[model samples]
Target: MKGWRAFLLRRLAGTAAVVLLLSIGVFGLLYLAPGSVQQTLLGIRPATAETIAAVQARYHLNDPVAVQYLRWLGGVLRGDLGTSIRTGVPVADMLGLRLPLTLALTGYGTLLAALAGVPLGVLGALRRGRAADRLVVTAGVVGLSAPPFAVGLLLLVVFALGLGWFPVYGAGEGLADQAWHLTLPAAALAVGAVGMLVRFSRAALVRELEQDYVVFARARGLAGPVVLGYALRNSLVPILTAAGLIVTGMLAGTVLVEVTFALPGLGSLLVESVTFKDVPVVQALALLLTLLIAAVNLLVDVGYSLVDPRVRLGGGPS
Candidate 1:
C-alpha cells in the first residue's frame, strides 16, 4: 500500500511537471507569433495606438510571458478559463457546453474498439494460419489504411445519404438520441484504433500462449477456456498500453472526424477558435487535452498493478 501510494504520488508529480513545460512551450509559441493579440482581436479595423493600448491593457498583452502564464494558470485553478475575445463568453462555459459531446464521442469510439478488437484479436490468435486469421489481418490492414475523415465521409454517404438510416447532421438531444447521432462519427474515429488493437492484442496473446507457463498449464490438463483465460490475463498489460495509445490518438483524430461529421464538439470548436485566433480558447483546450492524456497514462500505470499481481509499480513486489 505504501509503495503504491508513493508510486501514484510520483506519477502525479511527473504529470504536473510535464503539463507545466508543455504549457510554457505553447505559451512561448503564441508569444512569438507574427502580429500582436490586439491585431488579431481587432481584425479588419484600423489599429490606432489608443485602441491597441486598450486591447493590450485588457488582455495583459504587455506582460512578460511568465507573468501571463502564471495569471492564466491561476485563473484555471479557480475554474475560470478566461473570457473569449471573440464572443465575450467564458472559455470555461464554452468548454462546458462542448466537452460532454466530445467525451461521449471519445468514450463511444473507445468502447467500440475494445468490444470489436479484443474478440477479433483472440480469434485471430487462436486460429493462427487459418482463413479466419488471414481475413482478420486483411481487414485490419484496410481499416488502418483508411483515414478517419475518409471513413466518416464514406459512412455518411452510405448510411445517412444513400441508405437513409442515421441522421446526416447535428448532435441529437438526450442520451439515446445523442448516442444514435454519434454512432457513425464514433465508428470513424474507432476504426483505425480497432485495427491497431486487433493486431496488438493478437500478437500479445500469441506471445503469451507460447510462454513456458502456458505450456505447463496446458500439460496440467487445464480446460481450453481456463488455459485461454490465463493467457488472456497475462497479456492484459500490453493490451492496456495499446488502449491508452488508442485513446490519445482518438482525441487527436476527433478534429477531423468532427469536421467531417459537422458535430459541435471540442474538435470543431478548436478549429473555429484557431481560425478566429481565439487564444484563450485554444490555450485552455490544449492544456485540458494535455491533462487528459496525462490522466489516462496515470490510470494505465495503476491498472498495471491491479491487473497483474506479479507486477509492482515502484519496485519488486513487497
Candidate 2:
C-alpha cells in the first residue's frame, strides 16, 4: 500500500512537471510564431502606435516572455484560461462547451474500435493460418491504409448522402441525438484504430498462446475457452498499453476527423484558433491536451499493476 501510494504520488508529480514544461513550450512557440498577437487583435486597421500600445497594454503583450508565461500559469492555477481574442469569449467557457464533445468523440471511436477489433483479433489469433485469419488480416490492412479524413468522406457519401442514414453535419443536442449524429464521425475515427488494435491484440494473444503455461493448461484437459481466457488474461498488459496509446493518438487524430465531419469539437476550435492566432485559446488547449495525455499514461501505468501481479509499483517485479 505504501509503495503504491508513493508510486502514485511520483506519477502525479511527474505529470505536473510535464504539464509545466508543456505550458512553457506552448507559450514560447506562440510568442515566437510569425505575426504579433497585438496585430492580430488590431486586424486590418492601420497599425497606429496608439492602437498597438492599447492592444499590448490590454493583453499585457509588452511583458517579457517569462513574465507572460508566469501570468498565464497563475491564471491557470486559478481555473481561469483568459479570454479568446478571436471570439471575446472566456477560454474556459469555450472549452467547457467543446471539450466534452471532443472527449465524447474520442471515447466513442475508441469504444467502437475495441469492440470490433478485440473480438476479430482474438478470432484471427485462434484461427491462425486459416482462411478466416487471412481475411481478418486483409481487412485490417485495408483499414490501416485508409486515412481518417478519407474514411470520413466515404462514410459521409455512403451512409449520410446516399442512404441518408445519419446526419451530415453538426453535433446534435441531447444524449440520444448526439450519439446518432456522432456515429459516422466516430466510425471514421475508429477505422484505423481498429486496424492497429487488431494487429496488436492478435500478436499479443498469439505470443501468450505460445507460452509454456498455455500448453500446460491445454494438456491439463481444460476447455478451449478456459485456456483462451487464461491466455487473454496474461496478454492484457500489452493490450491495455496499446489501447492507452490509441486513446492519446485519437486526441490528435480528432483534428482531421472533426474537420471532415464538421463537428464543433476542440479539434475544430483549435483549427479556428490557430487560423486567427488566438494565443490564449491555443495555449490553453495545448496545455489541456498535454495534461490529458499524461493522465492517460498514468492510468495505463496503474492498470499494469491490476493486470499483472508481477508488475510492481516501485518498478520491480512483485
Candidate 3:
C-alpha cells in the first residue's frame, strides 16, 4: 500500500503534464479543421460578415489561437469546458449527464472481459494442448479477428433476435433495464478485450510457470495448485497492463457498440459533435478521452508497482 501510494504520487506530475500537452494538440487539431467554426455551426459555407463578426465577438474567434487555447484551457482548469457550438448548452453539463452512461457500458464490458477471459486463459495455459485448451484459444482468436460491429450484429441476431433475451436497441429505461439492454453491446465490446486478455494472460502464465521459482517450488514438494497460484500471482502485472489497454480502448468510446445499440455515450457524442461541427464539444470530449487514457495508463503503472517489488522499490518508469 505504501509503495502503491508513492508510485501514484510519482506519476501524478507526469500524468498532468501529458494531459496538458494532449489537450493542446486536440485543441489545435479542431482549430485547424476545414471551414470556420461559425460556418460549420451556422450550416453556411459562406457566412455573412455581420453574423461572423457576432460569433467572433461572442466566442472570441478573432482572438489569437494561443489566446483562444489558453482561454479554453483556463476554463477547463476552472471546472468549465465551454458551451457547445451547436446546442448552446455548456459542454461540461452535456458530458456530466452522458459520461456515467458511457462509464457504465465500459465497466460492464470490462467486467465481462475480466471474468471470462482471465479464467479461460489460465485454464488454456494449464491444459496446454488439450481439446478444451485448443477450443478456448481458437475462440479467443476468432473474437479478436472479428470487428466489433460484426460481432455485435451476430450477438444481436443470436441473443436479441433468436433467443430474445436482451434488448435489441437503446440502453433501455432504468438501471436494471439498462443492464439488460446493455448486455449485447457489452458482449461486443468484451470480445476483442477478452481475446487480448486471454492471449496475454496465457502467455504471461506460461512464461511464469517456466521460471526457476516454479521449478524450485515443485522441488520443495509444493502442491501443483500451490505452484500454479504462485505463478498466477507473479503473472498479474502483464495481465493488468493488457486490462488497462482494454479500458483505454473502452474509454475511447467503443464507437461501433454505442452506434449499433443506439446508446448515448461519449463515443456517439463525439461522432455527433463532429458531424454537426460542435467544436467545443469535440475539443472537450477529445481532451477528456486523452486524459482518461493517460489516467488508465497511470493506474496500470501503479498496478505494476503493487504486483512487483522491484517496480515499487527501485524501478522508475520502466
Best candidate (score: TM-score):
2
TM-score of each: 0.92, 0.94, 0.88
Ranked candidates, highest lDDT first: 2, 1, 3
- The C-alpha local distance difference test score for the whole of candidate 1 amounts to 0.90
Q: Give the per-residue lDDT of model 2 (tens digit) for 1-318.
A: 888789888888998888888778877777777887877787889999999999889888898989988888898899899999987999999999999999999999999999999899999999999999999999889988999899999999999999999999989999999999999999998999888888989999999999999899889999999999999999898889889988998899999889988899999999989877798899899988988898899889889989999999886887
Sequence-dependent TM-score of model 1: 0.92
In the range 1-318, model 1's lDDT, one tens digit per residue, is 788789878888998898888878877877776766678788899899999999999988898888988998898888788998778899989999998899899999999999999999999999999999999988888889999999999999999999999999889999999999999999998899989989999999999999999999999999999999999998899999999998988988999899898999999999988766677888888988988888888888778889998878887663
Model 2 misplaced stretches (Cα beyond 4 Å): none
Which ranking of candidates, highest TM-score first? 2, 1, 3
lDDT to native, each model: 0.90, 0.90, 0.85
Off by over 4 Å in 3: 1-10, 44-47, 219-221, 313-318
lDDT of 1 at 43: 86
Q: List the residue pairs that clash in candidate 3.
A: none
> For each candidate, how many residue pairs have backbone atoms clashing (under 3 Å)?
0, 0, 0
Worst 10 residues of 3 by lDDT: 309-318
